[model samples]
Each structure stands twice: as structure tokens, then as C-alpha cells.
Target: MKPMKTSYFPIIALSAVIVVIIMAGLLLSDAALVVDFASKKQAPSLSHPFGTDAYGRDVLLRTLSGLSKSLLLGIAASVVSGILALVMGIIAGTAPKWVDNAINFIIDAIMSIPHLVLLILISFCLGKGLFGVVMGIICTHWTSLARVIRGEVLQLKEQQYIKIAQKLGQSPWTIAKTHLLPHIFPQFIVGIVLLFPHAILHESAITFLGFGLPPESPTIGIMLAESMDYVLSKLWWLFLPGVCLVAVVIVFDRLGKQLKARFDYDNMRG
Candidate 1:
């Protein structure tokens, strides 16, 4: 089987830009570059790449701050969800029938709820904050990966390698450690990249709806929500950040899809 060629230069480029934006946001917070009322709602110029918000805050800085939080939250949610899913799926897949059934049922019930609503409920229940948002997004987003991991494990357990190990008197733990886990690690990593967009979108939506991040947290959704009031007048800066948020989300989604196709095709060929 030939390994499929995959180019991640675009992802790397986008990620670099994101990192630069984060650094700028962190640095500018200590010393404001036009964040007072005088710069509020000013149009884009050589000085301000993204214009200014209602408070005259540099729109670029605010957007970058929001982007930083969004990226961090997205990654946190993806990692938490992916790890939980992998652990749960492996246990259920390798264990007895009752455990598997229970896991499957719970996953199905959770997935049946609309994602936005689930995020909001979780966020609200946990109390609004960055940590709450991360937990909320992770709680709701792992069902799909759980299912995928469960299927993969079930299939893998029946494979010749696994059976050979079992026949050789290898303990279940050893078989799983030596064979199943390594084989699934790549799929798990790829699944995580794919999970980022969903986690990001849900995080934004929850924050926009006032259930995720705090009002002053500079999250992309909060920025958009704050911008909407003055969108018609005096506050173009508030809305501009939303556009940047959309662009970043789109970039992650596109990159994830590309990587998924590349990796999945390679897996199939192998």
C-alpha cells in the first residue's frame, strides 16, 4: 500500500499567523495602542489594520485576543473530548457486553440533543467562564469520536495480529498495549484535528448566546455579540472581529478536511 501524499503547509502557515496574532494581543494588552474612546469606530488605515471598536480599542488587537482565546479553547475542548472518547471507547470496546451497551446508549442519548443547546446547557450549568466553556464543549463533542473509536477497536480486535497475540497466550492487556493502541494513535490524532472546528463553532455559539465565556473575555462570539448593538452605527469595529473569527474557523475546517482525506486514504491503501 502506497502512502498518500499530504501537504500541511497551509495549516502550518495559518497556525503561524494565529501564533503571531496571539503574541500581539498579549503584548498590546499591557500597553494600549489606541484603545480609548478617541479611536472608537475608526475605519481601517495604515495604522489600524482592523479598525477600532466602540471603546476605541484597536480592532486588530481585540480580534487577535479573541482569536487567541478561541484557538486555545478549541484545542482544550478537542483534547479533552478526544482523550475521554478514546479512553471510554477502548474500555467499552474491550470489555464485556453490558459496559459496551451502556456506553453506546449514553452516547446516543447525548448525541440526540442539538449540539448548540447542549453546549448552552452545559455552560450555564457549570457557570460561565473559559473553563466552563471548555468543559461544556468537550462534554458534547466527543460522541462522534467515541463511536468511531469503538468501531475501530471492535474491528481491530478481530484482526489477525490481535488474534495471533491472543493465541500466543498474550494477556488482554499486553495485546491491547502492543497492538491496538499504537494502531489507533494516528487515527486519534487525525480525529482531534477534525474535532477542532466543531468545538470552536460550538464554543463561539455558546459564548454568543451568553452561556460560555464572560462578557469581557474577548472571545470571538462575545466580540460579535458586543458589536451587534452598534453594528448599524458607531461600532463597525465590534463587528469586524466576527469576520476574522469566521475566517479562522473556515481555515481550520478546511485544513482538517484535507488532512482527514489524506490520512483516511492512506489508511485504506495500507
Candidate 2:
């Protein structure tokens, strides 16, 4: 097939994302309320695309709802983590000597711990609910992005124009606002977009391990975990949510890579 026009790429990407979100949303309302023991464990068919789970709930609807839930949580976690990364990066890159050292030390301290263990500890401490998962993800996910931005800003700070601005008595804040931020914004956007998949995967992992959301929650992790029982029983529905989760993750990962390329310094200059 012929390639699409460059101008249409974002439109296509945005439409795919919207279609996924909209379908997930539309299926959410019906998924949570329907349960018929008579249809329990049905195979995939025309009337039930994903069939029914062992509980007789429509697997397709549940998968869609779980996907929507996970995506929303991932978005929230990524945004919070991204903002934390921005603040930490800015401080470490541009702050006074002592402040920079302090922030760097804190980052190192956190990085010393195993990430999943840290997430579990934090989530467990926060009581393992929606808030716990969000907070845990936000706290743990910022270090790498912060480090990237810190390096970018450190390089920017040494530029001849930055020195000129300092010599001309421009305040640090003023120089940062006018020069540093614009240079790093692209990097920042790329980091945030990339963070989404990690957030989603980590959220699911922690929830599956029982350190995030509760069993009562309608999340992708719960569906996958619960579906494990039927996997060996020749039940096609067991893998339905797992497949959907993989597809969603792949889509977001592709979107993130595309965003990164679009904002890439070399690509933009070209």
C-alpha cells in the first residue's frame, strides 16, 4: 500500500487512539452489569465476540472496560510523574550548587532501590487502592526522565548565549524561561508520551501481584489474573483480555515512538 501523506499522520494516529478510547468507553456501561450463568464459558462467536467468562460476564465488554480503566489510570500516573520529572530536572539542572547536589543525591538514593519493590512498598503503604497505585507510579517513574532533562539543561547552561545572558545580568529564572525551557520542551513531551506504556504495564503488574488495586476493581490486571483459571480448560475467553492488553500497549508504544521522532531535535532541524 502507498504511504499516507505526512500531514495526515497525526490525524491517523489521533483517530486510532480515539477509536480505542471510544470503543472502550462505550463498552464500559454494559460490561459491569451483565451476568448470566447460563452462558458461562461460551466460546467466541458472532453474538459474543469475546465470549463469556467463567462468571458468565461478557468477556468482550469486560475487556473493553478494563482497558479503558487501565488507560485512564495510566494517563493520570504519567501526567503526575511527568510533572514531577520536569520539576526535579529543572531543579537539578539550573538550581544553585547546593540545591542541585541535594536533588541529585535524593535521586540517587531512590534509584538505589529495586523499582518494583519500591513501587510495591509505596503502594502498600498508601493502602493499595486507586490513589495508592497513582501515587506509587508517580513517585517511582520520574527518575529517568529527570536525569535526561538534567543532562539537557546542563548542556544548555554551558552554551555561549547562556553565558552572555548571565553576563548581561539576566536572572537565572529569566534565562531559563526564555532559553532553557524552549530547548527542553520537546524532550519533555517525548519523555511524557513514553512514560504512558511503562505506567500502564507497571500498574498492571503491581495490581496482578496484589499491591495495587483491589480485587473489586475492574482492571486489566484483575481480568488477566482471574482468567488464569480457565486457560488450561480450552477456554478461549481466558486470553481475550490478555490479547487486548497487548494490543493497547503496542499502540501506545508506537504512538510514543512517533511522538519522540516528531519532536526529535535532528528530525525537526531536518
Candidate 3:
């Protein structure tokens, strides 16, 4: 018999850390809002591992709160984007030539724009809040995944089983439901997982640029934006939130890679 795989350990550990961060953020969210003028601008100490911001709020708690919000936003945006990609991909894969051409042209148009610029414009047009940021991410981030899914579907259309399904006189919708979706499910999962980091980073960047969440919001982007003024003042702790954001992004990136590898291995074995 083969020895037990040890590769799952990293995945488990990384997932646990992310869960804890999200949970801690939810729990500390209310507490993070409590400001103490007397404690403002304090450096890192035992009581405040990340120190106090100029507003006298606990940096660590606030960071956690922001991270949680970001994670949730990322989840929401990525899932929506993934679903959108799935729909467009199916249409492109099964539709008439003119329809597929239209879809490809639209995808190309969206992809040609600088991602961040498109995100900013969408968010701004949507009125620059939670809804705006989420819509922006969903619209901008779906293009790449949609293209991937479209390619997968196109390839699947050539497979013997799919050809047989077509010969069976199955409708495009039926074939998509019965054949395409199951085959592409793994890719969808992987795409969504990989999209999380991009969603989170874009949200933060949009917020930082004042096109996303409001300044009063407890988000990493807001935290970093607020820290900018104090950067020259040697308030090193102010940057802690930015560091945490980077760590969280890295964790998500690693988790996506691990999941992709696991899925690829499973596919190969199958």
C-alpha cells in the first residue's frame, strides 16, 4: 500500500489560518470600533501587538476586522464572477458561430483595458461603496475565468462523449447541464479559489484609491490609506495592517496553488 500523503498538511494549516482570521475579524469587529483617545498613537507593546493608530483604535483588531470584511467581499465577488463566467462560457461553447464571435469580442474588449482602471471606473460609476466595489470586482475579474471556461467548453465539444451526446439530439442546455458542467466543475472551483486573491487585492486597491469603501470603513485599504500620513513620522506600527494584508494575500495565493495541485493530481489519477 502507498504511504499516506503529507501534502494535505499545508493545505489544512493554511485553511485553518484563514478561517481563524475571518472568525477573529467577525468577533473583534465591534471591539475594533471602540476608540480610545488616551491610547492613540502608542507603539507596539504587550497590550497591543500591532499598536494603536492615531484614532486610538487597536491596530490588530482593526486589521482583523478589515481582513474579515475583505475576505467576505472576496468570496462574494469571486463566486458571482465564477458563475458569470460559467454562463458566458457555456453560451460561447454551445451557441452559433456569430454568438460565439460576439462573446469572444466582448471578452477581448474587456481584457484589453487595464484591470485596475476598469475596476475603478466601474466602482465609481456604481457610486463607490460596498455594492460598487463588489460589482466592479465581479465585472472586471470574470473575463479571465470566462475565457478559461469558454476554452474548456470548446475543447469538451470535441470529445467523443460530447459528440455522442450531440448525436443523441440533446439540446445545448441539456448537454451543458449533463456533460459540460460536471467536466468543468473542477476548473470552476480552481478558478474561484485563484480569483480570491485578485478580488481582495483589487478591493483594497480601489478602497485605497478612494474608489471603493469609504474611509470610515474598517478595511485594509482604508487602514493603509490612513497610515500614509504617519509614514514619515516614524510610526512604524501604522504599516502593520498593510503587512497583514500582504500575508493574507500570500496565504490565499498559496492555498489556491495547493488546491490546484491537488485537483490536478486527482484528475491525473482518474
Name every residue pair that clashes in candidate 1.
Answer: 40-56
Question: Which 10-residue span in candidate 3 carries the lowest summed lDDT?
Answer: 1-10
Per-residue lDDT over 1-270 for candidate 1, one digit per residue giving the tens place of the 0 to 100 score = 565677878878977887887777676654433458866677888888887777777777777777777777788889989999898889878989999999999999999998888888878888868777888888888888888888999999989878888889998788778888887887788789888878877888888888888886667788788778876786555677777777777777788777777777777878
TM-score of predicted model 1?
0.91
The candidate, 2 or 3, that scores higher on TM-score is: 3
* Candidate 1: stretches off by over 4 Å: 1-4, 31-34, 234-237
Poorest 10 consecutive residues of model 2 by lDDT?
Answer: 2-11
Per-candidate TM-scores read 0.91, 0.90, 0.94
- Give the lDDT of residue 172 in candidate 3: 83
Query: What lDDT does the true structure give each of the candidates?
Result: 0.80, 0.82, 0.90
Residue 247, candidate 2: how far off, in angstroms?
A: 1.8
Q: Give the clashing residue pairs of candidate 2, or none.
A: none
What TM value does model 3 have?
A: 0.94
